[model samples]
Target: MASEGAEYDRTRGAGDTAEATGEGGRETAAPPDPKIAAAVAAAEAAGPQHGETVRIDSWIWSVRLVKTRSLGATACRGGHVRVNGERVKPAHSVRVGDEVRLRHEGRERVVVVKRLIRKRVGAPVAAQCYID
Candidate 1:
């Protein structure tokens, strides 16, 4: 008799041990791919750690707020970007908790720095680096 919430393994016949099949007759999770593991390890190694300072333009691009680093720099130079209520240059330093405002394509994006990352990451990872 199987419990109401328990999974039943009907395939298990007499003398068939659970170890021969898997955990409770379910297959085990496969090991991570070597290439993916290496890429993740490399990203973690190169990613910004605590108490790191990153350039405003660089940070913007790294967080995926801008499509490219050059666009970020251009926006800064054109006075289309502001950090903490002050217009700053591309080389300006941006720290955690600073509010960044960028006006692009007639729209404004406001974000608060939560983590500082230097290298460009995937959109999901980039989203973790800021609070919008």
Candidate 2:
């Protein structure tokens, strides 16, 4: 699962490298791109990718998980959702890779983000947008 420009985890034992996980688990020593590093630093400095907090209505709402952002917002307002392990309002901001925990109707769901947008995208697109 090798991809270009992936960072290796140096903490692993030497032979563990061959297990060869990519991206989150990549084991190869790859150099960081200066340009990318600069851009990432700038984004971080500007704020958390999507900002410290973002309104649910402004995001590509995860409908299936909790129904419309409005519903999600309602749930959030009612303290049904948590961002980074803390309960937040429906308007609490989210960004790429943000971990979300959703509780609804006695069931709990956990998801990790793979993308973020400011519009209502279709189901397939929304699915692609998350990595739960």
Candidate 3:
């Protein structure tokens, strides 16, 4: 047991890309694919193309308004989330241009939907999804 503990293996984490690339130090992020870039740009430029909607909890979580989907749902259930001047449920569908008010961390965050995104994105991208 002592020998085994002394011989413990040290493995790199998934994020240790530099070590994988011949100790190149931090690796730069490759440019995004053009097709995906175009899609994201279009999505950021416009609202939902069709009569599309996403759950309020999902939208809030996707846009980083909350740390997790469950937190967003809890806020909705606790009446801490409101849409268009009315409290809504976690499953309530949030449409583009609707105003959302979230009471979180002892302050109220009021924002309007500029774009609808169903997936969590980077802070920059998430910031584009709403109007502060």
Candidate 4:
């Protein structure tokens, strides 16, 4: 009976292992990937690593400058966006605290960067990235 039960346990699924062991198995609480863990630890040890300043063209599309990322691209195409007093293309990369000028629908606006973000964000979260 003991040998048969041991064989059954060996073939059990991950869920079964968790239930039987009273602790979530490696499938549920696995350690972070070693490479990612090392990277994170290194970054943490780096002590508030300040990023290098970048140009606005490099950040426009990536940070969702306009409505859509593609819209940011179009705005650059249409000469509606300028970085650091120079009209730039979508390829311009923006750095933290860089000044930006944007023209849409014949209206011009200015902003300063407070943060750099690559993901599309909601209205409230998006506000955190720039100063209008």
Task: Write model 1 residue lDDT over 79-118, tens digit each, in one string.
Answer: 9999999999999989989999999888999999987778
In model 3, residue pairs whose N, Cα or C atoms come closer than 3 Å (at least 3 residues apart or on different chains), thus clashing, are: none
Give model 4's clash tally: 10
Estimate, for each residue in 1-132, the C-alpha lDDT of model 4 and write its tens digit: 999988887778665866867643533453345554444344335322366444454455434556666777788878889878887877786777778998876788788887665544445445556788
**Ranking by lDDT, best first?**
3, 1, 4, 2
Measured on C-alpha atoms, candidate 3 has an lDDT of: 0.82
The deviation in Å at residue 36 for candidate 4 is 26
Candidate 4: residue 89 Cα off by (Å): 1.3
Tens-digit lDDT track of model 3 for 9-98: 322444365467743322234224454455566545554557788899999998899999999999999999999999999999999899
Winner by lDDT:
3
- lDDT value, residue 88 of candidate 4: 82
Q: State candidate 1's TM-score.
A: 0.66
Question: Counting only residues 3 or more apart in sequence or on different chains, how many pairs clash (N, Cα, C under 3 Å) in candidate 2?
Answer: 2
Which portions of model 2 show Cα errors greater than 4 Å?
1-54, 57-63
Off by over 4 Å in 3: 1-49
Question: How does residue 5 of candidate 4 score in lDDT?
Answer: 88
Q: By TM-score, how accurate is candidate 2?
A: 0.53
Query: Where does the lowest 10-residue lDDT sum fall in candidate 4?
Result: 40-49
Better of 2 and 4 by lDDT: 4
Give me the displacement of residue 128 in model 4, in angstroms: 1.2
lDDT string for model 2 (1-132, tens) is: 353223344434444754544542422232254544444344335433434454653452643565576777788888878878998876676777778887888998788866555545445445555777
Error of 1 at 83 (Å): 0.6
